[model samples]
Every structure is written in C-alpha cells, then in structure tokens.
Target chain A: MKDDLTDRILVVLSSVLMLTAVYMIFFYAPTERVMGIVQKIFYFHLPLAFMAFLSYFVAFVSGVLYLVKKDIKWDIIGSASVEIGVVFTTLVLITGSLWARPIWNTWWTWDPRLTSSLILWLIYVAYIILRMSVEQAERRATFCAVMAIVGFIDVPIVFLSARLWRTIHPVVIKSKSIDMEPAMISVLAISMAAFLLFWITLIRIRSRVDFMELRIRNLEKIKRGGME
Target chain B: MKNLTYLAAAYGIVWAGLFSYLWYILSKQNVLVGRIKALEGDD
Candidate 1:
C-alpha cells in the first residue's frame, strides 16, 4: 500500500513536471537567432539524451549487482532499465535527425557521435535478443548481466566521440563554455528533471511486471512438478 | 515562423514515441494482471 501510494505520487509529480516542461519549451525559452524555431527541438533532444545515458548507467550498475549477488531482482532492474534506455535513445535519435534536417540539410550522417550512438543502440538490441534466445532463466539472466557489463564500455565512447574527434554534431558543453542562454539552460534543466522522474517511474513499473512474470513462471513450474 | 515544420515534427515524434511506449506498458500490465489473477484463482 505504501509503495502504491508512492508510485501514484510520483506519477502525478512527473506528469505535472512534464506539462510544465512542455510549456517552458514552447513559450518560456527564447528563440535562437540563427536556427529559429528548429532550435526548440534542443530542449527535448538534449534532455532525452541525458536521460538515456542515465538509464543505461543504471542498467550497467544493476547488471554488476546482479552478477555479484546472483539476485533475480537485480536482473529485473537491469532488464527494465535497458528497455527504457532503448526507448529514450530512440527518441534521442529521431529528435536529433529531425533537428539535423533543417540545420544540416540531411536526414542521416556518418559522423562519429552519430555512429557511436547508433552502435550503442545496436548493442542493447543485441542484449535483448540474447535474453530471448536462452531458454533457461538463470542462464539467461547471467548471460545478460555479463553482456550489460561489457556493452557499457560503448557508452563512454559515445559520449566522448565528439570531443575526441572532429565532428559535425554540436558539442553544447565544451571545455570552456556551455553554448546555451540562461533561459534555455533553465528550460533544459526542468525538462531533464521531468524526464528523469518519468524514467524512474517507468523502471519501477517495469520491474514490478518482471517480478510478476517471475512469480507466474515459478508457480507454473510447481504445478508441473505436482502433476508428475 | 520559419522552420516551424521541423520543430513540429520533432515535438510530434517525441510525444508520439513516449505515449506509444506508455500505452504498450499499460497494455502489457493489463494482460499480466489478468494472467496472475487467473493463476491465483486456480490456486
């Protein structure tokens, strides 16, 4: 009951934050002098990327914990986090491409940052496929835990690709300065908070669903054994 | 008003993706709830 109440509160808080963020993005933030209206996408795009990275990091940590403790709950957390990470990353890519078309004159480019992000996406897709292929629950969990740990190596590379190499992708946060105005930064921060809350809410719901599935599986196994 | 279409598309895709995923999660939850209830009933 306590957990249910907390979840409800979180859902309400996140929804309110999301609506406020949208309003700030469309109305409160000032328009860019150069990019015009297309620049508005930055409010959503940057925050989605930040949340995606945070989600993957959570999955990576959960994966490590699962390996250390051999707990199915940790595996559930890792799985749920990765699923949410993939969704956010997909949004990041789509919003990015949409932002690019007006500015870069192309739908796709083989730039380092873009390529590394795509690789990150592909790696998680492979992780999901791997989990599906293995029939044994324990074995599947163990394998996925390992894969999550290994695949996390790509995340740093994705983040650093623009810095390490010359790339067309804009580096908003540079060594010396951030390339955004005060109002823009404020809107971005609010949007990030909203998305982060939403991410946590989704992960909680997903992990609960995973727990239910685990319970059902165990119950079915017991029933089969009793019949024998 | 220039580049309005791009802004609209970007926002559209973001909301569409998020809402679709939310719908997917809720639908799956509904199915799982039914199955769990059925299992409990059997027990």
Candidate 2:
C-alpha cells in the first residue's frame, strides 16, 4: 500500500512536470529568430539527449556498485537505468529528426551530433536486448553491468568524435565560445528542470515495476518447488 | 514557402508522438491492472 501511494505520487508529479514543460515551452519561451516555431523542439530535444546521457552514467555507476558489492539491488538499478536510457535516447532521436527537418533541411543527416546520438541509441538498445537473450539472471546482470560500464565510457569518445568530425551540429553550450541569449538560456533551464523531474519519476516507476515482477516470478518458482 | 511546411511537419510529429506515448501508457497500465486483478482472484 505504501509503495502504491509512492507510485501514485510519482505519477502525479511526473504529469505535472510534463504539462508544465509543455506550457512553458509553448507560451513562456521566446521564439528563436532563426528557427521560428520549430525552435521549440529544442526545449524537449536537447534535454532528452542530456537525460539519456545522464541515465547511461547512472547505469555505469550502478554497474560498478554491483560488481563491488555483489548486490542485486545494484544490478536492478543498473538494469532499470539502462531501460530508461533507451527510451530517452529514442525520444532524442525522434525529436532530433523533427528539429533537423526544419532547420537543417534534411530529415536525417550524417551530422556528428546526430550520428553519435544514433549510435548511442543503438548501443543501448543492444544492451537491453543482450540482457533479454540470457536465460540466467545472475549471468545476465553481470554481463550487462560490464556492458553498461563500457557504454558509458563511450559517451565521451562519441562527443570527441563529433568534434573531430566537424559536422553540422552545434557545439554543446559549455564548449562553445558564443553566449546564448538570456531568453534562450532561461527556456533551456526550465526545460532541464522539467526533464530532470520526469526522468526521476520514470526511473522510480520502472524500478518498482521491475521489483514487483521479480517478486512475482520468485513466488511462482517457490510454488513450483524449483528451489531446494 | 518553406516555413509553413516546417511548421506543419513539426507540429504533426509532436502531436503524433504524444498520442503514441499516451496509448502506450494506457495499454501498459491496463495490462498491469489485469495482472493485479488476476492475482487477487487467485488469493
């Protein structure tokens, strides 16, 4: 019951954040002169990309914790994070395509950032699919943990490759020399906050669902006398 | 000439994507609710 209440709260909070983000992006955020209305996609797209990267980082850290402590909780966290990361990465790709269609005059381009994002999405999808392929839970989790750690390391390399390639994508804010307008920065900030909340809510919901599933499966095993 | 085309495409994708997510969540929740009900029936 307590867990149910927590889930309800998370659902409510997530809905609020998502709606607020929509409102802010549509009404409050100033339009970009260059991109016009299509610029609004940035509020969602870039944040989704950032959150996806963050999820992978969490997966890597959880993987390390699992390896060190041999705790199933750490494994669960790692797995859950990877699942959420894949979802967000997929969103990033779709939203990026939408944005790129307008601004870049192409639905899909070999731009450095765009290409790296696509690669990252595929790698994470493969990670999840790899987990599903294994029959044994412990072995699956162990292999996935190692993969999570390696995939997270690849993110920086992806960024570096994007820079080295000098494709059409804009440089990430921190690395760029030019300053953004105050309005644009504020919109990005609010969008980031909303996205952060949404990510946490999704992670919590996913983790709880995974926990219940594992529990129910174990119960069935016990009933069947599988365990000694 | 080009801007209107961009606007239509952007809004179309956004609405379509949101509807897709809504459908997904609704279906997933329905499945989970059914499972809980089945477990309750077993008890």
Candidate 3:
C-alpha cells in the first residue's frame, strides 16, 4: 500500500515536471537566430534521444543481472525497460524527421547516424517479437536476456556514428564543449530530468503489469489442474 | 515564425506518442486487474 502511494506520488511529480518542461521549451528557451522556431524542437528531440539511450542502457544492465542471477524479476525489469525505450526511440525518430524536414529540406537521408538509429530501433522491435513468440516462461526469459545483450551492441554504434563517419547530423556534444546558449542548456537540463522521471515511472508501472500477468497465468494453470 | 509548423508538429508528435502509449498501458493494466479479480473470486 505504501509502495502504491509512492508510485502515485512519483507519477504526479513527473507529470508536473513534464508540463513545466514544455512551458520552458516554448517560453524560456531562446530561439536560435538561424533556425528560428524550429530550433525549439531541439529541446525535446535531444532529450528524447538521450532518454532512449538511457533506458536501453538500463535494459542492458537488467539483462545482464537476469542472466547472472537467473531471477524472473530481472527479466521483468529488462523487458519493461526495453518496451519503454522503444517508445522513446520511436519519438526520437519522428521528431528528428520533423525537425529535419524544415531545416535540411528532406525528411530523411541514409546518413550513418540516422541509419544506425533505425537499426537500433529495429533490433528492439525484434526483441519484443521474440518475446511474443515464445511460450515457456523460463525459455522466453533466457532468450530475451541474451537477445537484449546482443541488441545493446547497436547503442554504442548509434552514439558514435556521427563522429566515426561522414554524416549530415549535427553533433551536439563535442569532445570539450557543448554549443548552446545558457537558456537553451537550462531548458534542456530540465527536459532531460523530466523525461528521466517519466521513464522511471513507466518502467515501474510496466514491471507491475508484467508481474500481474505472470501471476494470472500461474493461477490459470493451477485452476486447470484442479479441474482435471 | 517561419518554421513554426514544423515545431508544432514535432511537439505534437512527441506528446501524442507518449499519451497514446500511456493509454495503451493503462488499458491493458485495467483488463489484467479485472481478470485477476474474477479469477480470485472463482477460486
């Protein structure tokens, strides 16, 4: 009961932070002289991309723990994080395309960064599909743990593609400096915090659902056996 | 102001995608809860 209350309070706090971040993006962040209004998309787009990577990293760690400990709880956390990460990555792709349409005058190009991000998204999609195809819970968890670890290899590639290859994507964080005004940087910091909170809340909710699902399935099996 | 449309589209897509996912998860949770309750009642 106390845990449920804490979850609810965190959800409310995250929603408030999200709304404030949106307001800051529109009103507080200074507009870029070159890009004008479209530059505001940077506030949300970059944060979403960061959160996606963070979530996937969490999934990777959870996957490793699951393999090492052979605990179903770790599997639940791994799967939940991946599910949330996929949603954030999809938004990252969509917002990136939208921002590009006006700036680059093209929706997409097969740049290394873009292509690698797409591949990362596809790999996680495969992860979910793999989970759906399996029946036995233990086998499903083992396969998914291994697949999550394998899929995580794409994350570093996606992060490094802009630097490692010739790409049209703008590198925001260089080796020594970030090229953004103070206002923009502040708003981005708040937005990233908001999104991180939102990610944690979603992961908690998702893991609970996964637990309930497993329990219901066990209950059904027990009932069937009793009837027989 | 020139690229305002693109900005709006980007923000709209982000919020809509998030809300839609939240709704989907909540709906699934509600269904599972109901089923669990029914099963418990039967037991």
Ranking by TM-score: 3, 1, 2
Instruction: Report the alpha-carbon TM-score of model 3 versus the true structure.
Output: 0.95
TM-score of chain B of each: 0.93, 0.89, 0.94
Clashing pairs in 1: none
Candidate 3 lDDT over A1-228, as tens digits, reads 575687678778888998999899888888889888898888888889888898788889988999999999999999998999899999999999988898899999999999999999999999999999999888999999998899999999999999999998999888898888888888889988888888887887788899999999899999999999
Residue by residue across A1-228, what tens digits does model 1's lDDT show? 575577678878988998999899888999899888888898889889888888888889988999899989999999998999899999989988988888999989999999999999999989999988999988999999989999999989989999999999988988888888999989999988988888888888888889889988988887788789
- Each model's TM-score? 0.95, 0.84, 0.95
Residue pairs with backbone atoms closer than 3 Å in model 3 (clashes): none
1 or 3, greater by lDDT: 3
Off by over 4 Å in 1: A1-5
The list of candidate 2 runs beyond 4 A from truth reads: A160-162, A175-178, A226-228, B1-43
Cα lDDT listed for each candidate = 0.87, 0.74, 0.89
In terms of lDDT, the poorest run of 10 residues in model 1 chain A is A1-10
Poorest 10 consecutive residues by lDDT, candidate 2 chain A: A170-179
Q: Which docking class does model 3 fall in?
A: high
